[model samples]
Target: MPVANRIPILCLGLLLATTSCERPAPPTTAEASDSYNLAAYIEQQQERLQAEKPMVLKSVTTEEKPTETIQTAEIDWEDELSVFAETDLNRPALQEYYTREERVLPDGNIVLEYNRVEDAEPLVHYLRLEMTPDRVLRQLNALIQDQNILFYSRRNIQLTADPSSGNISGYRVQGVQKLVLSDSLHYQIDANL
Candidate 1:
């Protein structure tokens, strides 16, 4: 064939190949709506789900019961104060002149006894100073109010009046004194009135 005729034939083949490779058209909105019914499709899906067996959940009941309950008793303030006063008066004073031996209970109650010199009633009078629960607590609080003071002083921990007892009798005292150390250790003293 002539070159001009061959060129036209090749052009025609290329045009046919390109035209044959067209993509399918997208579905129209009406066609898509007809294909899937929203309500009926959901109902059909629900029916299929309902036809399957359901998972069983067991509810467990506990059989264990609590064992014990704690109960506390009320304290007697008058008897407590009387006992403290007697104990303090009976304690023996230290050997040194005008010195007294003081004993502190685990609860911070204090007992002191002093020796009396001949004709020196001053020591006895001084020892007779009245102590009220509030007074004791106030004095103790003053000593331990500051952390610095508490750490430095060995005598920082002291008894305070018990708030519960103090209300019944203004003179009743009960409380604990805790001396905290730098290393987080604590020395506890307790007293009650």
Candidate 2:
């Protein structure tokens, strides 16, 4: 074949090979284990609140000032619920780092708790969830801690929801942070949706 004809054929072959190659699919939240998909749950909540645009009453308290309360319909659901979202432990990388325990209380409520392994120091040290017998979410609580030479931080995050509707009623985040050459800072945020 002429050089020009061969060049066109080679280009066609390259295009077909590239197009036929399969890209690996992203891991789903459920792939980790038989655990609750916290990331998916938070995403659903975000979508619901974003569509509803409900009025939010939020209060913030910091070491530098007194508590300030704000009420408005302009709420950033994603940001407001980010702590809960970040507490997701279902990532594939974390599947083996923690163990999940479940129990049913006398009141018939189901509780699920996740704790890190004896030697692992994961970002989320502990996570607990309270749910109805039918698996309706009631509350979620998590503790996140990180420390290094430059800074140290700890956060206790909680989310309360209506069991019947699975709608978040309120949430709270209490944290303390300390950085080199700076005094420890304490902050708390309580919000109702």
Candidate 3:
């Protein structure tokens, strides 16, 4: 063989021999288990997240209510007879339905009276108010608040009125009280009014 051809063959043989003689290094603890349990870990995380999550309602509904209001102007005066007659009698509208009288008794007390000429429901037909301005309300209150057996025993009404006009006014209520101890007593008083 030629010297040049011999040299090339020897070099190629040396390269193959050196490569085959070396051994691969052993794996360390961290690199030993390169394969992963990725699918199992993902499934476990999904279950834990579902367990910790709050429950939610699928659907809900709500309702609202309507309200109504009445206007004052629509109210009728005739319908409010009980409320109207309870005010001062000086009102011509009220006076037109009744006859009014005023008297001053011996003890310096003023008395004002009214009698209904026409029938009205839930209304007092006779009203007699006594005024003693100097007296305290607590003393006079009983006469107006409660039916005095002695005074209402026959045909009597306790009145509250306007001092200047002698017109019947209110005391807790205006004019005569509809409630009497007896309806018969009220009728007896009604005959007088």
State every prediction's TM-score relative to the real structure.
Answer: 0.18, 0.81, 0.27
lDDT of each: 0.33, 0.87, 0.37
Task: Give Cα distance to truth, residue 49, candidate 1, Å.
Answer: 78
Lowest-sum lDDT 10-residue window in model 1? 137-146
lDDT of 2 at 160: 96
Clashing pairs in model 3? 86-174, 128-159, 129-159
Q: Top model by lDDT, which number?
A: 2
Better of 1 and 3 by lDDT: 3
lDDT of 3 by residue, 1-193 (tens): 9999999899999999998876544333342232122223224433543444322211111123222222222222232222323333443234456665656679776555666675542134555545554321111111122344433322222323345543223223222333354343222111000
lDDT rank, highest first?
2, 3, 1
Give the clash count for model 3: 3
Model 2 regions more than 4 Å off:
1-33
lDDT of 2: 0.87
Q: State the weakest 10-residue window (summed lDDT) of model 3.
A: 184-193
**Candidate with better TM-score, 1 vs 3:** 3
Give residue 130's error in model 3 in angstroms: 0.4
Model 3 misplaced regions, further than 4 Å: 1-87, 118-122, 133-193
